[model samples]
Target chain A: MNESPVIELSGVCTRFGSQTIHCDLDLQVAAGQIVGLLGGSGSGKTTLLREMLGLLRPSAGRVRLFGVDLDDPDLLIQRTVRRRLGMLFQHGALFSALSVFDNIAFPLRELRCLDEDWIRRLVHLKLAMVELETAHGKLMPAELSGGMVKRVALARALALEPELLLLDEPTAGLDPDRSQNFVELVGSLQQALGLTVLMVTHDLNTLAGLATHVAVLAEQRIIAFGPKDQVMTVDHPFVTGFFGADRRKLL
Target chain B: MNAIPCLRVEPGRVVLTGSWTLATMLPHLADLQNRLAVPLPAGEHWDLSGLTRLDSAAAVLLWRTWGNAWPEALEIGELHRQVLGRAADLPREMPAAVKHAFHPLESVGRLLLKAAHNLRGVIALFGQVLLDLAYLFRHPADFPRKEFAANVYKAGAQALPVSALVGFLIGVTISYLSALQLKSFGADLFIVNILGIAIIRELGPVLVAVLVAGRSGSAMTAQIGVMRVTEEIDALSTMGISRSIRVVLPKILGLTAAMPLLVLWISAVALLGGMLAAMLQLDLSLNYFIENLPRAVPVANLFIGLGKGLCFGLVIAVVACHFGLRVKPNTESLSANTTSAVVTAITMVILVDAVFAIFTRQIGVPQL
Candidate 1:
C-alpha cells in the first residue's frame, strides 16, 4: 500500500538551550489512523507535537504535513497545508474573553463566507457532537468546568473539519469517567470523520482503548512503534517498565 | 455555498430550498425550532426535496430540531438522508442553563466592598514590604541584588530618553504661553519667575510621576501579573523563595532609588527648554534666564520636587505590586489589573502632590 503519510518526521531533533529533547526521531502517520504518542513527563511529547504543528522548529531534520515540508519557502502553500490540520492545546487555550459559541464560531468566522445563521447552526451542531447543551454555548471559558472546557475546545477544533487532529494531553486534569467519555467521544468522531489523529498522552487507558497504533517515546527516541499489542511486547527496558506497570489493564 | 437557504411555511407544510450549506445564512433555525415546538396541524410535513444543495451542518441542525430523529412525514434524497441520519446519532446532552439575578443596591454594595478589600490588600502589601526590608537589612547578603539592578535598569536607565523628550516639550509649551501673556503687559522678565517655579517645584515631579506611572508602573503590574498567571510565583514559593523579597521588594527599591534621580534629570531638561523658550519668545538672553532662575525659584524648590518624586515612586510601586499580586489566573484579569494599577498609581501621585502643596506651600516661595 503506497498511501501517502499525512504526517512525516524523519531524523528529527529538538533542543532547548543545552538540553536535547529528541534525537534522530522518525515517525510517519498515515491518514485515518489514531496514533497514541505515549511518553512520561519531560519526555518531549509536547515538544514533538509542537514541532509537527510548526510551532517549534527541530534543530535537525524536517517535519512534513500532507507531504509538504512546513518550512516550505512559499508561505501560502504552508498556510494551506496548515488549514488541513487542527490542534487542541494542553490547556484548551479557549479565549476566556469569548463565549463558547463565539469560540467555536471563530474558525468559521475567519473563513468569512458563512452568514451568522450558518455559523450559529454549525456551532450548535459541533457543540452537540461534543455532547454540550445549547445553553453551555453562552458561557465563558472561565465559567466552564475543566471537562466542559475540553469539550468546548474539542468542538472548536472540529468546527473546521480538519483532516488531521493533533491533541496534546487531551485527558489531563479530567476525572476518569470524564476522561473515558472524552476518549469515546474522540474515537467516535475520528471514525465518523475519518480523521488522522496524533494524540500526545501518558494515559495508558487511552492508548489501550483507542490507539490503533502506538509510539512510545523515552530517552530521546521512540523506544517502540507499531500496533499497540506489538509495541506493548517490545523488549526495551522503558517499554517493559511502562507496559509492566499497566499490563493487567492494557491487556 | 453560493445560494442562501430559506425555509417557507404554509398552513401544513414546510418547504426548504436553495443551498442549505455551511456558507448559507440560516438565521431562522431558532425561530423555526420554536415554531415547530408548538402543536402543528396533524398533517404537517417537512419538504426538503426542493433543496438544491445540502451539507452535514444543515442536516445536523434539522436533525437536532427534530429531536435527534427523522421527521414523521418528510421528503429527502439519499445524500441528504445519510447526513441527517448520522447527525441524528451524535451525542447532545448539556446541563440546564444558570440564571443570574441582578440587584442594583447589592451591586453597589459589592462594588464598595471590593474597593475596601483592595485598599486593605494594598496596606497589607505595604506592611509586608516594610517587614521584608527590615529582614533584608539584618541579612544583607540574602538580598536579591541582581533582580534589583535589572529592575533599576528597566525602570530608570531605559526610561531616560522618553522622559527627557516629554519634559522638554511640556516646559517649552508652558513657557511659550506664559511668555506671550507676560509680554502683552510688558512684564516679560516675570516669565523667568513663572517658568522657574512651575518647572522646578510642580511640573517636573508631577510630569515624571505621570509618565512613570503609565510606562514603568503598568509594566510592573503586567510582568508580575503574567508571572502569577503562569504560576511562576507559586513555583518560586515552592522552591522556598520569598516573592516579596525576590520580586516585589526589588521593584520597590529600584523605583524608589530611580525616581529622585529621574526628577532631577527631568527638571534640568525642562529648565533648559524653558530657558530656550524664554530667550526666543521674550527676547531674553539665555545667560539672564539662567542667572535669574536660582534667585527666582530658589534651591529649596528642587529639594521639594525630588521629595515629591520619591514619594510618588514609592506609592506607584506599591500600588502596581498590589494589583499585580491580585491578578487572577486569566488573561482578562491580567489586563484588568494592569490597567487598574496604572490608573490607581496616577491618582495616588496626584493626591500626594496635593498634600505636598498644602504642606510645603510656604517653604519654597520666593520671599519678595
Candidate 2:
C-alpha cells in the first residue's frame, strides 16, 4: 500500500456542451493489476481511456500517473512519463506509410540509443511474441487483415517494454478463436512483464479471461470497482442486468 | 522507484542487480555497453539472480553480451530465463530487401509503358462519362442533379474572390507596364488594344485554368482518393450504382458549365483593373477606353477565351478523376495521386491552349 498507484484520477469531470460524461469519477489502479473498464454503448468508456492517456483533459479535477500530474508543463517530464506507458488504439492506428517492421521499431528508434542490431532483435522478438512471422514484417499496414493489424499494433505497443499498457477494445473485430488467443497472449505477457493494464472492453469473455479487477462506468462515474467476483455480487441494477445469466461461467 | 541497473566485476564473477528494463537502461546505455564489453575472465560467471526485473530489451542486450549463448556458469531466475528465451529464439538474419538491377533501355521502356497506361486510363474514363451522359439523357430521373450542382458550387462559385483578386492584380501590372512603353512612342491609345487582346484572349483563361487546377482539381482527386481508400467507391458499386454516373460525370459537366462563366467574370474584372491603371498612368479617359475596346480587340478573341476555358475545365476534371480512381488503398498513394492530378491538369490546360493558339491563329488577331 505504500507504493503509489500507476494511475489515479480524482473528481474527474468531462462535459461536451451540457452533456456530461464523467462527473466526480475516481479510480486508483495499483501496479500489476489488469483492470477491465466495462460500460454500455455511449457510456464514454473510450472517452475515459483517452482522458487517462492525457489525450483529453478533464473539465475538472486531476489525473496523475506514477504520482506525477499529467498536465505538467516540463517537456522532459512529459516525455519520461509517456515513455513508461503504451496505448493500443481500437483500430490499430498503425502508421500507414511504414511497413510492419518500421511501425514496431518506431518507439525503439525514437529512443536514439539502441543500434540497428539490438532493435532488429527486439523487434523480431516482439513479432514472435505476438505470434506473427518475420515475413509479415515487410507488409504495409494497408495490406494487413483485421486480426494481424491488432497483433502488429500489440507488438508496437510492447516495443518499449512499457510498465503501463492501455488497450482500447483489444478484441473487438477478431473472430472468437482469435479473440481468445489474443486474450491469452495479453494475459501471459502481462504476467511475465508485470504490466498494469487498463483495458476498455464490452466483451464479457475478454473481461473474464484477463481482468483481475473490474471497474464499471455508469451514470457518469464508476459504480463498482473491485475484484470481478465482488463487483458481480454488488446490489446494483447495472451489475445485475449486465451479468444476468452468464454470471456462473465468469467466476 | 526500483534501483538503477548496476554491473560489478567481482573477483570471480560479474554480478548484475536492480531493474534491468528499457526505461532504466536507456540513460546508462552507453556506459552499460562499455562495461559489458570487457571480456570475462576464464573462471568468471554471470550472476543475474539479484535483478528485480528483466525486460525484453535488457534481455536482448544480455543475450548479445554473452555472445548469443548462456554463460558457462550463470545464475538467473526462471521468469528471467523465459524472458531471455524469447530473445534467444529470434532468427539471426533479417529478411533481405529485394533489389532490381538498373538498365537504361529497360527504364525508358518502363516509363513509356507507364505513360501509355495512364493515357489509356484517361481515354477510358472519358468514354465512360460519355456513356453515362447518354444514359442520363435517356432517363432524366437517374441524373445526379444535386451532385452536379454541388460540384458547380464547389469548383466555381467558391473560387470567385481569389480568382478575381489575382486577375485584377495581373491586369493592373500588364496595363501599367505597357502604358510606359506606349507613352515613350506617343501611342498612349494603344494600351486599350494591348490589354483587351492579351487579357480577354489568353491571360484570363490560362490564369484561371492554372488556379483552378491547383485548387479544385487537387480537392476532387483527394476526395475520390479517400473514397477509394475507405472502400466507399466499392460500396457504391455493390449497390448497383455506377460511379461514373454519380461521381465522374457530375464533376466534369459541372466544371465545364461553370468555367466559361468564370472566364467571363474574371476577364471583365481584369479589364476594369486595366482601365483604372491606364487612366492613372496615361491620362486615358475611361469613356474612350471602353468604346475603343471593341474596335481594338476583335469579337473572335472573346469566343477563343471561352472556348479555352471550356476545354481546360473538361481536361482538369477528367485528369483529376482519372488519378483519383487509380489511387490505391494507402496514404502514400492518396498523396501521390493528388499531386499527379494537379500537375497533369495544369499541363493538359497549357497543351490544349497551345492547340487552340495554333488552330485559331488566323481568326482572332485584329487587322493592324
Candidate 3:
C-alpha cells in the first residue's frame, strides 16, 4: 500500500472451460523478497506462476508486476521482465541436444546481445558456480547424470544474470543430499547475486531452510502469505495439512 | 411461428432469404434442388425482407444456385441492407480458367505448390546429405565412439552375411550358366571369366549396396524417427546443438566412409565364393580362376562398381534422413517412415542404375 509491490494480484481467476482451476485469488510480494509457492500438485501454484509470467491470461482480475498489468501484457515489458527471470524447469529440462556450454549459453544467446567469446566465458563462469566440470560442456545431455543435468540447466538459467529466479520443483528426483546441496546453492546464489526467488516446491527442507518468505496456495488462493517463520505457523487447517505433508509425499 | 431468419443468402448482386438459422436449414436447400431438379426462383432483384440475419452458408448457396445466369453476384452490404441491391457489374464473361483464380481451383493450385515445396525439400535434403558427406572430415570427431562402432557393426559387419549368401547363390548360378555355355566351345576355361567378371565388376557392389540400403537405411530411418517422436531431436535443438551436425552428419559420414570398404571386401569374398562354385561346376582349379579373374576385367569396371556403390551409399543416407524428417510425432509414423525409407532408397537405386546403364553406353564405357 505504501508503494507498488514487486508483484500484485487481485481477484485473479483462471478457468479451463467449465473447470475453474483458480478463482478470485489475491497475493503480493514486496520488493527484494524470495517467496515459496507452496501447494500439492494440481493446486494452481504453476498456473499462478504462468499467469504472472503472462503465458496464460487470467479470465478475470488484475495482475500487476512491479506496475504492469499482466492481462494487457506489453510485449516490451514482457521481454524486459523475461530478461530478469530465470526458470529452472522440472527434471531441469536441459536441452538434450546441447552441450553443457551451449545449454548454459542459451539464455545469453536468446536474451543478450553477447558474442560467442563472452557467451563462452559467461557459460564457464556459471558452470564453476554449479561446480560442474567445464570439460563436461562438450558432452551431450544423455551422457550426464541427473544431478549434473540439473546443474547445467541451472547454469543456463543464470546465463543472463537474471534478477528473478523461478524454480519449478528444483530438488525433485534428487537424493536428499543432492537436494540439500541444490537448495544451498540456490540460497547462497540468491544472497550473493541479490536476486528475488519464487520457487514451487514440495520440499519441507526448502521452506524451512531456504525461503525468506512463504505463500501457501489452497482453495485456489493463497491462504497465508508472510515471512517464512510467520507463515509457517499452524493457523490455517490447509496450511497445517500441507506442512504436515511427509517427505515421501514428493516425487 | 413468425418467420425468423432462416437463410440469408447474399453474394455480390444476388440475394435469397428464408426464415431459419442457416445451419439447420442449409442442407434442405441442397435437397430441395436435388433429384426433383425444380428450378428454385431467381431474378434481377431478390427478396431478403423475410430474413433477419446473414452468414456464409446462405451466401454460398445463393451463388451456386444462380451463378451461371446472374450477371453479377450479391454481396452483403450490411445487416440493415436486407434486400438485394442494384445489379453489380461483374466479369461473368471471363474464361473458366480466369474465374478459377477465385475459388476451389485456387486450393488445387495450393496443393501443387505444396507438392512442389515438398519435392524441393526432398531435393534439398539430398544436397544436404551430400554436403554433409563432403564436410565429414572437417568434424569427424562429432561421431561418438559408440555411434561409429554401431555404424560399422550395423552397416558393415551385420550386413555382410546377407550379401555373402546372395553373392553365393549368384556365384553358383553364374558358374552353372558358364559351364553350360562354354562346353559348346570346349573352352570351359571361360567359367573363370564368368566368375571373375560378374562378381567383381557388377554383382558384388550392387548386391552389397542393396543389402546395406535395406538394413542400414531402414535402421537410420527408425532411429531418427524415434528421436523425432521422443523429442530427442528437440532436446538437441534447444540445447543449441545442430541435429544435422551432431546426429545426421555422423551417420552419413560413417556410412560413406564404411560403405566402399565393405563393398570391396564383400566383392572379394563373393569372388572367392564364386571360385568355390567354379570348382564344383567346372572342376576348375582355384589358382586358374584367381589368376585369370584380374586380366579378364580391367580397373575401369571396378571403378564403375565402386562409384555406383558410393552413390548408393549417399542415396541410402539421404533417403533414410528424408523419411526420418518426414516422420510424424508418433510410433506408427516411425514404422511407416522406416519402411518408406528402405523402399524409396531401393527404388531410387534401381532407377539410378538404369540411368547409369544408359549413360555409360552413351559415353562408351571403358571396357575392362
Candidate 4:
C-alpha cells in the first residue's frame, strides 16, 4: 500500500476562455483514504474533481491516478483501470423510461458481457445493500423520490465493485436525516468494501463525520489540506470563515 | 339571383343542406363553428364528404372555421393531413351542375389525354410513392408498437365506414349524374358500366389511400417525430439498435401488405353500391350487373387498383418518415412537417392516379 500515492496533482492550472478557475494546484490523495474536496459555490471544486477523473486536461502541470497518466492510457492497464472506477453524478441522471432494476443494470450491461444469472445476482445484492427491495425494481425513476434516486445511483455506481468512487455533490438536495444516512452509508461502504473515495461537497456534517482527510480549495489552489483535525484547526481566513459559517449553521 | 334557392353547408364530415348566402350563412356560421368545435379526429380525414353543394363563401367559412376549430398546436403531422384533407374534399362539395359551370378545363383535360396516349404520370407518381415509402425507416428500431397499431387502426381499419359510404355514394352519384345526361341519349342502361369503371379504376384506389394517408401517415410522422425529440431515439443509438429497421420496417411491411387488400375491399364495396344504385335507378338486376362486371371492369382493373394501393402505401410511409425525420425538437417544426406529409402524400397520390389513367390508354402497355 506504500508504493506511491494513488492520486497526485502537481501545479495543475485550468482556465476557461478568459477566467482561471484552478491555479497552480498541488494535492495528493492516498489509497484507502476517503478525502473531501471542500469549497464554496464559485470555488471550482468540481473542476478539480474533473481533472482527477481525466475528463478535463489541466492547463498546466499534471494529474496521475493509480500511477497512470490519466490523459494517455497505456494499453496494458486499460481493462484494470476502467474496471476499478465509478462515478455518481450530481442529479443521479437515471433514465426516466427505464425501471430501477434496469437503471442499476445499465453499467453492468455496458461494461461486462456477463450472463443474466450473474448480472441479476450482482444487481440484486447491491440493491438489497441499498435497502431497496427486489420488487421495487419495476418502478421507474420518476416514481422514486429524491432519496431513493440517490441510493439507486449509488447502487449503479457500485455495480463494478470499484476500487475508487468519485462522487460530485452526492448529498446536495437531501434532508438532514437522509444526508446523515447517506454519509453513514458512504463510510460503511468504504470500510466494508475497501473502497477509496474522493468526493466534493458543501455538506459540513458529512465532511466532519466521514472524511479521513480533507482539503479546502479556493483562489485556484489547495489553501489548506491535512488530516481531519489538522485541516479543521488551521487559521487561514477562508478555512476559519468557511468552517465557522458551517459551525454557526450547525448550531 | 343566378344562384339556386338552396345551398348546402358542412363543417367536417357532417353536413347541413340549405341556402348559405350572406344572410342565411351568417346565422348558420355560428352553428357550423360549434360543429367544427368538436375536437378534430387524430388526423385530417374528418369525414367532410357531406356537403352536397359548395360555394366561395362556404369555402372561406370552412377555411376560417379551420382557423378557430383547428388545434394547430398538436403534432404537425395530424394538422397537416386534416387541413389538406378538408381542402381536397372542399371541391367535391360543389354540385355536378356547379362543377360543370366551373370546370372549363374538362375539355382541355380530355384533349391532353387524347394527345399523350400513355400513363407516364401514374408510373412517375408510383415512383414518388416508393420514395416516400422508404423514408419511414430512418430510425427503424425506435418503433412504438402501441402508437403504430393505434395509428394503423385509425388510418386503415377505422376508414371502413367512410370507404363503404364513399363507395356507395359514388355508385349512386355516378348513376344519377349519368342517368340525367344519358337519359337524353337512351344510354341510361350504361350507368352501371360507367360507375363500375370510375370507382374500380380511380376513385377506389385513390380515395382509400388518401384516407389512409390522412389518418395513418400523419399519425406515423407525429409518433416518430416525438420519439426523436424525447431522446428515446438517442438511447437506441447508444444501444446500437437501428431505429429504422426496428421502428419503421414493421409498419411499412404491414401497411404495404395490407393496402392492396384494403383497396380491393373498398373497390368491391363501391361497385356493389353502384350496382345497387343502378338497380334502383335503371331497373338492372344485381345478377345482370355482376355478370357484366367481368367484361366491363376486367381483372386488370383489380390488378391496377392493387398496384395503386401498393404505390399509395409507399408514398404515405415515405412522406411520414421524411417529415418525421425533418421535425426539429421545437413545436413549430412538428406542425410544418405534419402539414407537408399530408399535402405531399395526397398530391402525389392524385398525380400517380392521373399517370395511371394516361398509361392505361389503348396502346403498348400490357393489360394486367
Candidate number achieving the greatest TM-score relative to the actual structure: 2
lDDT of 1 by residue, A1-251 (tens): 22669999999998889999999999989887899998888999999999999989999999999889989999988867776678898889999777898899998898765556656767877887777878788888878988888888888887876778999888888888878888887786675556789998888888777889999999898878888788888888878877777876787
lDDT of candidate 4 over A12-72, digit per residue (tens):
9999998999889998888788988888788888888888877789899998777677766
Give the better candidate number (1 or 4) by DockQ: 1
lDDT digits (tens) for residues B1-368 of candidate 2:
46899998898899999999999898899999999988877656889999988999999999998888877898999888889988889876776546699999999999899889999999999999988888888999999999999999999999999999999999999999998899999999989989999999999999999999999999999999999988999999999999899988899999998898889989999999999999999999999999999999999999999999999999999999999999988898999999999988999999999999999999979898
**Roughly what TM-score does model 4 have, to 2 decimal places?**
0.43
- Interface RMSD of each candidate, angstroms, one decimal: 6.5, 1.7, 26.8, 33.0
Model 2 residue B235 CA deviation in Å? 2.0
Q: What is the DockQ of each candidate?
A: 0.16, 0.72, 0.01, 0.01
How does candidate 2 score on lDDT?
0.92
| DockQ winner | 2
Query: lDDT at A57 for candidate 2?
Result: 97
Superposition error at B104 for model 3 (Å)? 49
In order of lDDT, best first, we have 2, 1, 4, 3
Decide which is better by DockQ, 1 or 2: 2
Model 2, A54-156: lDDT tens digits are: 9999999999998889999998998998999999999999989889999999999999999988898889999999889999989999999998999899999
| Between candidates 2 and 4, the TM-score winner | 2
User: What 10-residue stretch in candidate 1 chain B is worst by lDDT?
Assistant: B21-30
Off by over 4 Å in 2: B98-110
TM-score each candidate: 0.74, 0.97, 0.44, 0.43
What does candidate 3's lDDT look like per residue over A1-251, in tens digits?
Answer: 22677678999999989988888999888766888899877888888888887778899988877666765546776666566567887777776656677677776676434345434544555676677755777776767887887888788777665656788877777788878877777776665445678889887877666888888888788888888767767488777677655523321
- Comparing only chain B with the true structure, the TM-scores of all models are 0.81, 0.96, 0.63, 0.57
